[model samples]
Target: MKHKYAESDGTTRHVWDVERIWKLAEDLEPFEIHIEEIRGLDSVTWFYNGDEPTVRSVSRHAGRILNADTSLPPILTEDFRVFDGMHRIARHLMEGTSRILVKKFSTNPEPDLIEKL
Candidate 1:
């Protein structure tokens, strides 16, 4: 899966091997975390281009957020950076859910590819 992080220099695009990450964490037990505990919640900007979201982009994300399956737990890093399921989290927040299930890696995994742009 592709993930992006904004840095001081520019946006860094991280390509992760989702299957591998899932294999590493799938057997581990999932736990519940308060929604406020996830720091990524504060920095969610769906637009990676640093521009205001267009109508199409907003509609796309809205559809995703609405359709997200809350039954599936989100995946997170050791320090709680989201590895997947931000849309699900958004769905939970919209529903006024205080906590959600998550699977976390014991250690962070290096991305398959990192492009600084």
Candidate 2:
């Protein structure tokens, strides 16, 4: 299965196999969710500020989120910005579900920072 993702600029597109994509998701460890606040979809407006998330992207993710098979959790930055699991987020917005579970990272860590911690 082929998956396509458009860059925020809307000038470039990325294509990958579905298996590879899911494999990458599986590789990601579930980070600890320490933040207590439940943020709404608006909290991460930056993600869709431009043409970052097209309709196709949202629909595709909505399907994944609607399905209960994948256990992938949402990931967020320290300031509560979402980077991964945008599909699940879209699903929440579509279903009028205001709350989501996300693991916040202090920063986009480098190898050195990850190793030090």
Candidate 3:
């Protein structure tokens, strides 16, 4: 899977290989972090576009959020950007959970691709 981050200019995309990052984090012990402390939560658009989310898009995320397995921890980078599992975090938040497990990479991985749109 590929994870995308919008560049400061908004037209550029930084894409990371989620599988590669997950592999790097597999051996790291998981730790708990307050749900509010996750930077990804600050942006209301991680799972889908907040500005104009389509019905299909919303439905897709709703299913993922509902089916998200909380037992598995979310993966984050050293700077706290989510590498994967945003839906799991969303599920925990919606359930009013204060804290959740996460695996953090000590170092950030380079983007597999970057492109300007």
For all candidates in order, the CA lDDT equals 0.78, 0.48, 0.80
Compose the digit string of candidate 3's lDDT tens values, residues 3-74: 554433478777778888777788989998888878768776644444467788788889999999999999
Which candidate should be chosen as best, given lDDT against the real structure? 3
Q: Pick by TM-score: which candidate is best?
A: 3
Worst 10 contiguous positions by lDDT, candidate 1? 1-10
Better TM-score candidate (1, 2): 1
Error of 2 at 28 (Å): 11
Ranking by lDDT: 3, 1, 2
Error of 3 at 37 (Å): 1.0
Model 2 TM-score relative to the real fold: 0.40
- Each candidate structure's TM-score, on Cα atoms with residue i matched to residue i, is 0.80, 0.40, 0.81
Worst 10 residues of 3 by lDDT: 1-10
